[model samples]
Target: MFYDVFVFLVIILTLLILSGLVSASEVSLFSLPSETLERFSKSKIRTHKLIAKILEHPQRLLITILISNNFINVGIALLSTLSALRLSYAININPEYAVSISIIVVTVLVLLF
Candidate 1:
């Protein structure tokens, strides 16, 4: 039981980090200057070409990021809820109250970092 909870917490943390990275990447991509994008488009590097392709349709990229970020956030919320449930069970606390507390704490943590 302890090990399961530990693993779940680790997964939740990993999801949070991935969510942050995706959010940051979206901002970084949108903030790139047109000149930089043009230069990247002309480059022979495979990664540069991929980035250029993604940037060609900024709206599509934005939509994709938003969708992915939503999924990640949901995953984080679900995992945290489960963690709270497990903790509350172990401590003989009410699961209903734990749910609200978990969501608030997770939201604050995500926003803080």
Candidate 2:
């Protein structure tokens, strides 16, 4: 039980980190100036080429990022609920309320930072 909870916690943290990175990257990509994008599209560098391709379809890229972020947030909430339930069981508490509280707290923390 302890090992299971530990694994879940680790997965939750990983998801949180991934969520942050994806959100940051989306913001960074959208904030780039049109001149910079044009330069990237005309550059000879391999990385620049790849970035240009990604930015070519701006709407598609934005939709993909938004969807992925939503899924990651949902995963985090589910894992947090599971972890709370496990902890509540170990301490002989009610899991029903714990799950709701944990989900709300996790959502708030994720949004705040």
- lDDT tens string, model 1, 29-102? 99999998999999999998899999999999999999998898898898899889998898889999999999
TM-score against truth, every candidate: 0.92, 0.92
Report the lDDT tens digits of candidate 2 across residue range 12-109. Answer: 88988999999999988999898998999899998988888999999999999999999998898888888899988988889988898997889786
RMSD of each: 1.2, 1.2
lDDT of each: 0.90, 0.88
lDDT of 2: 0.88
Kindly report which residue stretches of model 1 are placed more than 4 angstroms away from their true locations once superposed.
Answer: none
On lDDT, the leading prediction is 1
In model 2, pairs of residues that clash are: none
Model 2 scores a TM of 0.92
Error of 1 at 65 (Å): 0.7
How does model 1 score by TM-score? 0.92
